[model samples]
Target: MKTNYLALLSLISILPLYAQQVKFEDFFTDQTMRIDYHHIGDAKSELVTIDQIYGYGIWAGSLLHLIDNFNNGAYYYKIYDEATGALIFSKGFDSYFKEYQTSDAAINGIKKAYHESAIIPYPKNKIRFALEKRGKQNELNEIFNVLIDPADLYIIKEEAKDKDVTVIKALYNGDPHTKLDVVILGDGYTSSEKAKFEKDLKRFTDLFVSSEPYKSNKNDINIYGVFKPSEESGTDEPGAGIYKNTVLNTTFYSLGSERYLLTEDNKTMRNLAAFVPYDAIYIMVNSPRYGGGGIYNFYCTFVSDNQFSDYIFLHEFGHSFAGLADEYYTSDVAYNEFYPAGLEPVEPNITRLLDKNNLKWKNLIAPGIEIPTQWEKKDYDANDYIWLKERTAMNKNIANLKRNKAPKEQIDAAQIEYNNKDKAHSDAVDKYLKSSKYWDMVGAFEGAGYSAEGLYRPMLDCLMFSKGTKPLCKVCADHAAKIIKHYTE
Candidate 1:
């Protein structure tokens, strides 16, 4: 009886090891399968429908890590072997449709549609694909599922688009399968601006590799740039009544936020990106506007010429790559209840602090420090409130001036005045925050994720929380390092 019991325990220990030993060639091919679909719905209801499937470039994702263990993103997808019904692959990603659902238009029962694509390793046989979304209580519920056959006649297998597009190998470490691959695309650069695009790509790549956790793991990354010129020189500024014939159709004023820049042309972007192997996408606009946007595992965008361009690049990538939540609650955003009350956010940087003993980043908390570590919130908020109001009024005034076709000198002077004041305020705030007793500590700092209360950040100041060249907080850095390992190791 003792021998039998010991054997049963031994069997249990080996089960998980066997499950983790899923081979890549067992159920997948060497190519890529992209499932395109239309995500339709409003705030109350959502639906997804198949559009077209494409067979494209060689698979670039990690062959070892087929399953995503990170519980991130608003939506999740799973691929299963049809014959055995065993889960083979899965990933979590945020989509533009998910963000749009939180917009006022969706809240008012206005339905919209967004084209999205799911890229996976080509299957060796028939497979079942399923997509799940997070409910109000943070549980994933399956919303869409379909059976896909590898040999389907309707699958589009064609030549790669934009063969003539310039490809710049900004940084190459090794095989893409063994490294985290990042593809950078340019928009709104005219054909004559090819040199400028290359220069901009090099600058961004250097900055990316110089920043820590990426800086520490630079050898595990590969960066590529896909440059396709547009007929115009800059992206659209709808609030200022300016439009351009850009390649990606990127624009500012996304979801009514003046500085939020994003592109809805997912298909075109994907087509261009097919030229290379990538795990993440970044769009670099040719404009000088102070605008950019990022969605977890979806994409990130930033303008090329701006005083805060470097900060935006690093900050937005934190969201797109590491799933870090915004740590600032003072700024206005189009999202309504982005992080719902009474629930913990999936982002690693911010939490609801429901369980003090089991904090998301409990291991990193400072020794003997309080869980809800208090900071100079009242003093900061008082100044932030005044700055926020001034910023809104300044943006409105500039937009109106542009609409009225004000002289270039007049517009430039107004912008200069505002920029000067903005710099002063930012400098003062940074100095004040650095003087805090908890500035160098790792503890739950209140006021994060668009909530002035409840949601707590991992630090007092980080790239996610402010407009500076600050490194990611310790919690965010650890999460990012894990993601890097997921791709490379």
Candidate 2:
């Protein structure tokens, strides 16, 4: 009798707390489709660049929102699935203008633009988003209601700041509750362009939300954009000249080149981390320039631009966001011998094949498919191959004949042709590796596995790092899907 009485009391005491949990359906009505952009300068008019249409357009139909904020930013809370504990949604908004001027300036500009027609002076300063989670815990419950199976619940308060940048809190409610969020910032633009940028993002998110993986748990995701205006519109490197590629004409300040290169600037990385507690943070470089990078357990991202921007965006996202290893290895890179032969690589595509009897995907290989020696000298003719001959001879320290060493009279002819053709091969590799839809994993491609010396990939044309129908090998797909399952509710 005493035990029953205690159990009843426990139930009574927990009822209030349980009632406070936030549910996913509650915030649907509260979402506001707002316009966002930055004022770079008056030197350029409010014009839409072609790069924007192509690059950002690729993700045209996607959904994004803050997973943890509600009720005009009164409180904040993040949601995670009970089964996996991966964070699927979040919004951590809890800052006032006094904490930083970013949200304040952005709010002012937005308000001004909403009311006036005149062009406003571009804010020279850059605004970063930050979250305040230390105080004001009471109001959180009213705005957000935490829900597990829509039965248990809690509430929380959050605040959204309008300054030089519109900053909001975010959270993860996926299976793992793995703290992850992305801040998609745009380049500098005029007031009109800023408005357009916001519209474009809204459209993109709408499409994203309708997609397969995201549509499954649309309510649990939080996505927001911070309008940090650069000095000019389009692709550009800070304090550098504009670069024109096949798809975009913009300043390419990062490494001062249109092609992909790492930058010395760590500000974007540091500031992004400060905004939210993220297990993985991503930077969506707003340019039509095709490039991206992924720092494991840190961050991953791609730039915005045309000229194969859609393909490159997904490709880079696979690398930066999913840790997918490069599958193509024939193109020129500055590094050498990245992967040792003995150590087993974590990436699914490349393998030591050390123990073919116990190989990773041995079952998938066709019965009697020739293992090792499949790509012996007989596969490729040794002589009369100018490109292969040069690379092989160089690696072997073999000197070329007289005519090969002479400087060519055509300045841009040979090098340009080489770059263009080489890029085509790389594009082909990227396409195959990212498709993630087909292929059996038995061996390596001729030029993959980070072997600067060899150009082999696991499959004849798998997406380890190539283009077209040779979908991402099976192992790579499983690896990427594992992460998706981890973070989805």
Best by TM-score: 1
Alpha-carbon runs more than 4 Å astray in model 2 = 1-162, 167-182, 187-192, 199-222, 235-258, 261-263, 272-279, 362-368, 373-442, 452-458, 462-464, 467-471
Clashes in candidate 1: how many?
Answer: 0
Top-lDDT candidate index:
1
lDDT per model vs. reference? 0.90, 0.38
Model 1 over residues 329-390: C-alpha lDDT tens digits?
99999999899889999988999999988999998999988889988899999999999999
Residue pair clashes in candidate 1: none
Candidate 2, residues 412-442, lDDT tens digits: the string is 3544444465456456434444453323435
Error of 2 at 277 (Å): 6.2
Q: Could you tell me how far off, in angstroms, the CA of residue 430 lies in candidate 2 after the best superposition? A: 10
Question: In candidate 1, what residue range of length 10 has the lowest lDDT sum?
Answer: 1-10
